[model samples]
Target: MEKSAVYHRPSDNFAYSINKTTLQIRLRTKKADVQNVKLLFGDPYIWENNEWQIEEMPMTLSGSDDVFDYWQVYVSPAFKRLRYGFKLQSDADTLIYTEKGFYETAPLDTDFYFCIPYLHQNEVFDAPDWVKNTVWYQIFPERFANGDSSLDPKDTKPWGSEKPAVNNFFGGDFAGIIQHLDYLVDLGINGIYFTPVFKAYSNHKYDTIDYMEIDPQFGDKETLKRLIAECHSRGIKVMLDAVFNHSGYYFPPFQDVLEKGEQSPYKEWFHPHSFPLTGGERPNYDAFGFVESMPKLNTANPEVKDYLLTVGKYWIEEFNIDGWRLDVANEIDHQFWREFRQEVRSIKSDLYILGEIWHDSMAWLRGDQFDGVMNYPFTTNIKNLLAKQSITGQEFIENMSKVYHNYPKNVFEVTFNLVGSHDTPRILTECEDDEQRTKLIYTILLTFMGTPCLYYGDEIGMSGGADPGCRECMKWNEEDQNLDMKQHIQRLINLRTNERLLANDGEIEFLLPDSPNGIFGYRKYTEDKSIVVLVNSTDTEKSYSFTEPLSDIKDIYSGKTYTGSSVTLEGYGFAILNY
Candidate 1:
């Protein structure tokens, strides 16, 4: 037995409350090392005589990555408390794993077991139920459309006439979005995540000049209210970006600090290192990156917290916005987010709070702060496998297994999954303009777990590089759009909507490949029904055989029935099978 590889903890993903009465426990061991595991658990105070009374339940092998095999078991303690240990058996050895260390036999003392003192219902990781079912469409307002050209900014170019630049604008507004509500509805998008519609100087609107007012370039508050109402009427949820991490250079508080230096009442609102603030090279004060235009706000300040908290509540209270996507969320203090979650959720208990964090965000997703984070790790793995072709199918599955085990099931389900966004290159560009590869990427995205987000122009096969290049004006002309790609996406969305297994309905099991570059897939299943999603990442035809006979199998995507246990797919092909 590889004792060093065995691991477990009594908190976070390792152990957690799935609901008010049920507690889920997990154990990890080296891959293919342990033959079996039995969880020994009981109420800490249920002892009768001298021997601590406990019940043993066999742990099921939930999943296995490259290095570790994860085991899980669910229990509901009668006393709402638990003290647990594990008995792991390998081919040649059997060991009792406990809190103190490895023991030759199960210990009688409850001190030797890991503890969950009590299971509180509030501790269960509860995110808004609506988020899991949502398919998000991210709209960069400046590039989406221009319904009311009267609101165009000075020097606004004709829509789609030229390439996009950092400073260029095409006068996209709420009225424009309102005009295209039917287009989004037809695409099967139930949630719209608008990037920064608040008053800001930049076309991107990440730098907030005023938290309370809508950017005139986007439209007046009435236009935004109408937009939100239209979206709600169509059963679409609206999530506005909240750039509370920093303020634009023109933001009144930042301007006051820059002008007054020492005497400014808002000096403490920002992190100015010294008097006489300057914005050259590296700024004298802390800023977002080294960009002098965006100054990071000191959210720890009481007044600043109050102002931002108001901004958080004002939109939901007045306009009934469904969600807030926090910008630079990881850089801010946790206490502020905890308070922000409490403050915003108090108004709308089901309000979704998503954070823009690109790394492992377990710290912020403990049911106290963010309901979910921007799933950049997922984006990276998908891009590497499909777009870059740097990683093989087996490598992709192994890497993603680690990602799946990182968070609780509930938290993972609501994560914001995206392939392309305003900050990254368009998906078609990432796949080097190959429509087949781009379609494959969308197949994995829309069919994968969690809430998936599509960039504004990706569905129509728009091609562009990162940043300014990705923010091109939406092509409204039917001749200019890729109807095939758009239809492919629409079909995937329809499948996701009609089929519960495609969403977060059941347990997922990734079918590990036999070779490095072999075909890969995952099975999402309940007790009786199952859906298997297979992908052939290669450029040639490939065949995959089922371990057991699959009967009554139907290819949901193609509406074709299969008779055999094996299936064949063409290059860059995918299959959504229902059995």
Candidate 2:
């Protein structure tokens, strides 16, 4: 009926803008019989020229794959969604199974619609008047706090085996987080972003073991319901991390396939590969689809989708959460997400769905996949700019402008900006204990457009070098630490949360001084307010002067009064002004 799906990719769904420059194309299928597949395109519909005809751009895969089967095709780093597909020479004809063929993702899917009709209010892409005003705090549940020691992992636990390393087990349970919601409230965080609480094997819980049950070590579902209720009472909403990309090899159904082979009833739930290769002959299959401990699940399996949707809906229907922070998001099927986002809306129309994509939230922000993504590039750019010492203040502003221009208004308005996350060293350590510079980074994170995120212990000056190491327990004691760090953080956060002009809307720029190498300076303000941040990145003190009148803000810390643009800042100093 549709020319036998002349392309093996969802080419029809491929839509992008040249302003972003790059794009991506994704294809997923379990059939291992197809070989020597190559994608060819006639031409991209560049400029609706009243006709579709042009010489297409040609490209090839970076590596070789001769009939290799992938467990999943969650697109990684392929920036733009390209219009291309597989060309496999089948027996009678070289069949082209299109990605978003009419048989698969119908064009009627208005979720994939363009700008005007695709704001996705139901998916929280359409930010309400309330969302723009709230701040969020992300906590990996098991590492946050240990409120109930009684709930600690038992020897040879029922759900899964226990490991002894800090990551293996920390005994952090629901009661622990329940006990600390107030601490978050005190810190002025209006929302909580937690890692999964679902039953799983590893401590991180990325690989789900039991969909219906909560890990005993993490407390039962009742505890979760209570925590949600309590958080609501405190005016704080909860956003649970969603990690459905893959399941642990030991996950029940998958284990059934492992133990019973093709005879297993649930065997259809996964992409079959060389199984149970005992005798240690290197049992074949990409773990995490590419890593062995994390075998990818088949979200395309009707049963898998039905079961997972129920799990997702349960969280919203039961606990009334605000949204979801999808883990390893780019690794999911686009068709599946279109439905997933739709199903989530059936329960609650305005639930936020932020993907954990490092590259571009704009990739999926077309309104079909996710509302937002972790602004990794945003933070990483500044860090690289600082470390390389190659970028100037103006360069930083241009990069940010590029980011903002790529996404729709709402996404750019509510992105999550952070200095450090659970995966990296504390910003304090990255700054090498330069309290003044650390405070400047902190200042920029909040004063910028996105919703600022504070890693659990970063505010108190907790430092770690890398992964696992970055996840240290919270330290409450303030004695002997840099009092300046604590006070400075408090001031910045207060400004972000309480200042009317500083919260969401504002003009931002990095003001370069005459001595270009001397400082990293920026200014942010709306019609109602204005603040300037001048950072002396170097260590040795260097004095400098401002050229114009500066009277918009009363320096909260220095207790200084000024009404002239010509002012000066001390070395390593940052400022916040309201003008």
Candidate 3:
């Protein structure tokens, strides 16, 4: 409360630094109920198809105070702008605790997130507020659109085929995005969040091979310059997805360890004893994650921290990019993120940092590391409830309301909410292909609190089953889009950008139904106006008597007037009203 007693550096002057890619932490807080402060680092692994993949972080609290604080935990080889945060331990709240020990979410959604320090404050971090009051579109760099036919991969597979497979690249490149700037600007998207564009072997580029260079496939520096210049002229900001949690085996250091045993000078860059004694093979590393192709970089190494930090800052200076979306953000060392936020602000005070967080990230949102986090808790929760057909109207209201109260008020307004991203099935498909239900999903995303992001093709009625299936090429066809999907999305974006009441101020409440049926309702208002969104999750149309607060608004979508005591909604129906 009252912003809490915190000492923070001037946003303009702060920067995170690493010297040896090694670090030590000493606890500074006076509290003694100290269990162990777990030092965790890795990418925020995307949870899909019910699989969990994590990049392991080596812990070195090792009782050394000389290198770090008595409680100062250290990990290294950190990049200047890597995403990281802390997880603290106290006997008081046994439920859940991250470095700062705060959580906010609802039963409406079970997904949660850890808070980080890179959160841009409300002008507090000296970073100019993000071009707030704008719209964002998330583009999977490889699939959105291939503007240059020459750039299309010669070995690409057909989308959705079982043989060649969905994992194959579709040749979407930065130049492709540059070519479509006109299309996107016309659609009213002011910000673009491209999935990881760093050098990697795969189409997704999560296995970062080099942080400094944009993958040659994406385009060279010249292409990026033109794209950045054109986008800036058009008022569009490009945010690249930066993956810092691990490096591919092809990464120089990883390969060095493979080629030369203890003689390798870079041996300390990874988990100790991670390399095998024979053939200098790393049969495995301590990094207990999904696979070995992606070797977890020892962020605890001071040298590693310093190297990444320098690279992150370089991008801002080299290219006038707007910001970054940290991939697998949860797994990176906390020290790395703290230092990164400090440094990046110094480089470009206006940059925005978004983290890939699945859980309640309120702790990370506390005037620190990230300006906002991808709201998976809200996204997946809504998807699962709708898919299972068990979501209640009251449950919906209560769940979202909890989100409203979960994060710090100042930064909460800017969090990103979306119905689907590249990693999940399209919202329409996720909800069992029901057009009306997907419309309800639309209401939840565009009208709810925070900035809403629409996946590249979802607005045009793109459909798929799951992860690889959800990520498909953009449909240039205006007719194939289901139910005027593009137009509907345009309306939603217009509402978010144009309506002050809907943008920030809103009241979320559950209309407790007589039975346990699923029906959720929420309202947004300001001094001069109000907007209401009501959805029915059950098969049958739901009805309820009108009440004082809700009876006042008119349905903007249908121009229906409501008065008196009871109001009724058709089955699988939703109403958006304004008054």
Per-candidate TM equals 0.99, 0.73, 0.74
Q: lDDT of each prediction vs. the true structure?
A: 0.92, 0.62, 0.63
The TM-score that candidate 1 achieves is: 0.99
Clashes of 1: 0
User: lDDT tens string, model 3, 103-160?
Assistant: 4311111123332233222424222355446578899888876766566566764432
Model 3 has a clash total of 85
Q: Model 2, 369-464: lDDT tens per residue?
A: 676678886787667555434665445654564465445445666676777877787777787766666776776776677777888777777777
Winner of 1 and 3 under lDDT = 1
* Model 2 TM-score, all chains together: 0.73
Better of 2 and 3 by lDDT: 3
Question: Which residue pairs in candidate 1 have backbone atoms (N, alpha carbon, C) closer than 3 angstroms, thus clashing?
Answer: none
Which residue runs of candidate 3 sit more than 4 Å off their true CA positions?
A: 1-128, 157-167, 277-283, 286-288, 506-515, 549-552
How well is each residue in 481-568 modelled by candidate 1, as lDDT tens digits? 9999999999999999999899999888888776777789999999998999999999998888887876768899998777777888
